[model samples]
Target chain A: MALPLVIDIAIGQLRRRKRQSIVSIMGVALGVGFFIAVASLMQGFQQYFVSQVIDIAPHIVIKDEFRTPAVQPAVAAFAEGAVAVRGVKPRDEIRGIRDARGKLAALEAVPGLAAAPTLRGPVILRYGARDHSVALVGVEPERERRVTNIEKDMIAGRLEDLRATANGVILGIGAADRLGAGVGDIITAVSPRGVAVTMKVVGLFSTGLTALDQGEGYALLKTVQILQQRPNVVNSIRIRLADITQAEPLARVIEARFGYRTESWEETNSNILSLFIIQNAIMYSVTGAILLVAAFGIYNIISTVVHEKTRDIAILKSLGFTEGDIARIFSVQGFVVGAIGAALGCLLGWALIEMLAAIRFDFNNPVLRGQRGFIMSRSALPFIFAGGFALVSASAASILPARRAARLNPVDIVRGAA
Target chain B: MSAPPLLEARGVTRILPGEGFGAPPVRLVEDIDLTVGAGEFVAITGPSGSGKSSLLYLLGLLDRPSAGAVLIDGEDTGALSAPALARLRLARLGFVFQFHFLLPEFTTLENVMIPMRRLGRHPQDEIRERARAILASLGLQDAERKLPEQLSGGMRQRVAVARALANDPEIVLADEPTGNLDTRNAATVFDVFARIVGEHGRSVIVVTHDLDLAARAGRRVHLVDGRIVSDGPHSPVVPQAVA
Candidate 1:
């Protein structure tokens, strides 16, 4: 038969059995939906995880295989060489929260370089007998504005207030609210080394970001360095590069020259990243099982169709339909069903995603890293899942039925009661 | 014209092995020689269990004859590959069954269009025109678009007749085309067959238990216990019918 006529015949056959055709399509759609759901969730987890890793470290990081002070001298040398390389890191460090003055000044001013040291630590604060521990950071008033968005989070006080007071601290609005401290309230902090200091809450900030807005305090870097008893030494050197994603290579260059251990942003949170990968693998595998079951359902429906049409097959054969044509007719039916199911499933998956996003579903499953809840699926995984599931189910559904149709004894079916 | 008959067979034996282990082989249709010629309408008659259907199947290439040779247009069927055999069947053979074996899912038009599609050529309008013409010839012009399920028994059998002629086959092999019809319906099916063989110049071999229908053919071949008992010109009414 002409190929298009074969398709027409196949499609007409399906139209005749409208209910059966619809059920088969639904079977494929369910299979695809399950697959897409798993794929979307897996993809969301990956994005959340990869970003977290990037949040803490650079796009790439290279550390000394060993993490010990035994290589301290080589570490310094590695740091110096990394600084010597051109286009290595950004010429400025915007550690806006706090500044580590005397400790970071000399290293940052090294010619052909851009670096800054900011005070980053936690402090204990007491308000009317209620004491809570919160993170405290000190930044250079002028240079801090370049890198970070801390200044944009001014709740009530001004940046001039931070520059004017000798003992001034900027508090995250959440932290200040919990402490019941206004912009002019006084707070006390004790350094890790047993040194105590008191500072006025001259400025309040709110970034509207969860991590930065709660339990955080900022002060002048020089004042922080003095209080912490690290006059010329900073806790961590923050590096920005011409290409942020090139941190691993940059860290490698620095580590190679200075012999110091370095870590990229990705490596900083490797555990959660591994967790995301593992979850995706598991979820897709589960979806595969669902697809298998759905395919099985489709197979069952098609098998019935083949059995019911035995007499029709005999007539077609007797009328000169080659075995290939018979098989193709049925296969065409399956392909149409699968394609339709996949298309519908795609729409359904998108609708479900929108519905989920609307509800702000929290995927706070402890197994997921960072307790993150809402994530949007933004990859080809959804289409792949739906299309893959439909294709596999559709083709699989046709196999046995098509074979049966091909193998039928035309004489027997035609002569015998069908 | 100088070659073998349009259909020629020699010692056509078919032995089917019983399924899986130890069951003895069953002789389904054995040592049968049958022939029909151009422009001839022959009828094969037998009691049930006489392998009348099996013999027709062997001739039609619906199933392979287990042993022996059957030639169509002088081409030995045994030597052709399965696909080649299928092609041979498509190119030359047509079939009608006791039941109206029209595809219930398709309309009478599509049923007629099937064999034409197997031709795999000709435009849509041409195919449709031919199918409509065939259905019209069968006096089923208005019902061509009606599904087989919607057709009456007589109409359905007429549709089957049209389908058998769709490819313009040299021979139409029917296994009891009228076994399920009433007397009138059976006579109507026979009437359609007579016109097809007479006007179209194509041969037809119908298997029937109905004596009236058998008597109407150009010749009659009788089978009993897997053997041909009588082969003759159409009738018990003709004294030389068994000669």
Candidate 2:
């Protein structure tokens, strides 16, 4: 019945002490504001990194070889027993998908997926008097574009131009610069078996990764097979899925069916993902300390109010106000301050993110030279988390002072009789 | 033949712990019994340390009796829970202290409205209306909106009285309500108490050291050494009621 009055008295007391209340509120606001801003920035950076990796590479890569080598026939024959096969070296084997056409046909049954087969081998490019060793990659242009971002990264000619010229090749921009080669320039591609073939450079691309830019030379699938002395064989197939998050499960299924090694983007980046988890832990603890300090500020102000208003408490008790009512009055004050602080802090955090995101910062590293800016996540979770933390801290800070106010004895307080 | 008393104290006692080790606890009020009927003006008078104020506190339910019970309108108060006792105090008893303990943060009208709000017997508008009426009747209409610090000593004391009568309790227990007032202010406060009993039909139990003021009551209970030395009606009604 008197709940409103109890809350009203609590608010009235805080209003009377305007400066003290404002100070405590600002403390909470600072804590929440920093928490939101920092958490959003960290999440934004993580998302930016993951998206870059996802956009450049296939979600799942299927290779013709297994991660672990197969045991010898003698070891396999001794099934449950340890077989000592001394002085037996593992066989030097040629690696390729055993039945490429059959596997490709079977993969078509998988829905919402794109797969492209590639034959990769080592080659040396010779232009004039200078020669450089590079990985010679053979890809079907139309199918490769669907599985990777190679088409979007082209700087000069088109990938479709490779199909027009039977013996055409594409050099990375860095490789082209090193060889002084241009579009339509004829270059000698020396095979590992010393069989040399002349091919015209039809295109060039740059992906901002120095290792890829300086080490890869692309050519037609038939051209690479003829040069590497391997006929009708693909070493790997790259796959793209409609949902990137489903890559691990889909890769497992594909590996199980094909008896080949498969790798998902998640498996490849597990180390970096675990690092992000640690970053979040550190971020929360640092931000949590700020909120704890703010709670102490609230505790200080409420303690002072309880001490100063001892007479008012006694008078209210004599007027038949219960102990619970007195405690509620002080708790209400803490809650109001926390709520107001969290609201203002959210606005402040949003503004901070916007301001930081507007300033551009250029990364000058040679491997990944690009324009970088403070990325701010637009998700609502950080704001909710900060507000909840503030409320809990504020409530905890109020308990002791409220209890002290409730425990006052009215008889000793009324007439100063004691 | 008459109606039972509105408040009764049967053999109530209170003991305070002594200061030194192994010292016995000092008794503030002994096995004393008293009753206050409706519309009765009674005064408890004695010298300093005679347990007069202690006895008033015990009867008012502000303090619990160590050995006996206090009954309000025939209900044994000892059996009630703490909250129930508080509710009984809110709906049935009022208290006036030596100092005008009006909440300094609130205006005079709000001070009077505190009890009514706690009791929750009326809506916001009605509470405001009754609070204003009480202040107006006490001749503090112009001062109703003023804070306690802004009012004179007598005006503040009157505000305290108005607050005491907020819930229209059956008994008003006053512990030296005029102890801090000057002679003129003391007389004015006594007049208000006299009217509360005479016109409103509410009982008033005051503890005082002023014999002149104590002599004006219909009955007097004098305490000495934690025991009632004399308890009875004063013969030949003194026509010295303040108003």
Taking all chains together, each candidate's TM-score versus the true structure is: 0.83, 0.90
True contacts kept of each: 0.60, 0.60
DockQ of all candidate complexes: 0.52, 0.51
**RMSD, each candidate, Å?**
7.4, 3.9
Best by lDDT: 2
Q: Where does candidate 1 stray beyond 4 Å?
A: A1-3, A30-115, A119-135, A141-143, A152-161, A173-179, A205-216, A241-244, A278-290, A360-375, A378-381, B19-21, B234-243
Q: Which ten residues in a row have the lowest lDDT in candidate 1 chain A?
A: A56-65
The parts of candidate 2 lying over 4 Å away from their true place are: A1-3, A65-72, A120-136, A165-201, A208-217, A226-229, A362-372, A415-418, B1-4, B16-26, B234-243
Error of 2 at A119 (Å): 3.6
Q: TM-score of model 2 relative to the true fold? A: 0.90
Clashing pairs in 2: none
lDDT of 1 at B101: 74
Candidate 1 residues B84-143, lDDT tens each?
Answer: 877777778888887877767678898888777777566767988988988888789999
